[model samples]
Target: MLIPYDQLEPDTLTSLIEDFVSRDGTDNGDDTPQETRVLRVRHALSKGQAVIFFDLESQQCQLMPKHAVPKEFFD
Candidate 1:
């Protein structure tokens, strides 16, 4: 399921973005600051370039690029 970013509390959204960006391999060898990474993800979310996905089975939420998600999820 798609979770709207706007619906999340400010702190929750910040934590989520921080967690996503801090995951291994996401940094891509760049020494980008955590705050900058979080801002980039937040910008992507606001621009519709990224989305928050909630998996029913695992009950986990993930931040993914919009194009990477299945089209049906948008409906």
Candidate 2:
């Protein structure tokens, strides 16, 4: 269930980006990196084509084509 990053809706797209940045276990203080990076890499899926990366630790990327994540989870 792999999806190109561009296919995600705006909200879901934001969530996914946040998930990726946070998944690496790195924190950027009080700033939200996804807000900036999502805009930067939004075209990655269009020009270079980005693929969702999934592993044992996270389940969101593993389940594509399904909006399994709720907005509250991110809050």
Candidate 3:
């Protein structure tokens, strides 16, 4: 489901973004500071360039680029 970013608690949003940026291959060794990475994601979310999706089956949350969300997810 498409959960609006504004609905998430501040701490929850921060943690989610931190987890995403912490992934092994996520940054491609850019070595950006954690806060900077988190801010980048925050900006993307605010601008509609990215979204947070919740999978019904797995009950998992995923951070994905706006164009990359599968069509079925929206249905």
Predicted model with the maximum TM-score: 1
User: On residues 12-40, what C-alpha lDDT tens digit does candidate 2 reach at each position?
Assistant: 87777666556554445636556665655
Q: Model 3 reaches what TM-score against the true structure? A: 0.91
Give the whole-model CA lDDT for all candidates, comma-separated: 0.96, 0.53, 0.92
Q: Least accurate stretch of 10 residues (summed lDDT) in model 2?
A: 62-71
Instruction: Indicate whether candidate 2 or candidate 3 has the larger TM-score.
Output: 3
TM-scores, all models, native as reference? 0.97, 0.44, 0.91
Clashes of each: 0, 0, 0
In terms of lDDT, the poorest run of 10 residues in model 1 is 30-39
Cα lDDT, model 2, residue 21:
57
Checking candidate 2 for backbone clashes, the offending pairs are none
Better of 1 and 3 by lDDT: 1
Give residue 11's error in model 3 in angstroms.
0.6
Error of 2 at 54 (Å): 5.8
Q: What does candidate 1's lDDT look like per residue over 23-57, in tens digits?
A: 99999999989899999999999999999999999
lDDT of 3 by residue, 12-31 (tens): 99999999999989989797
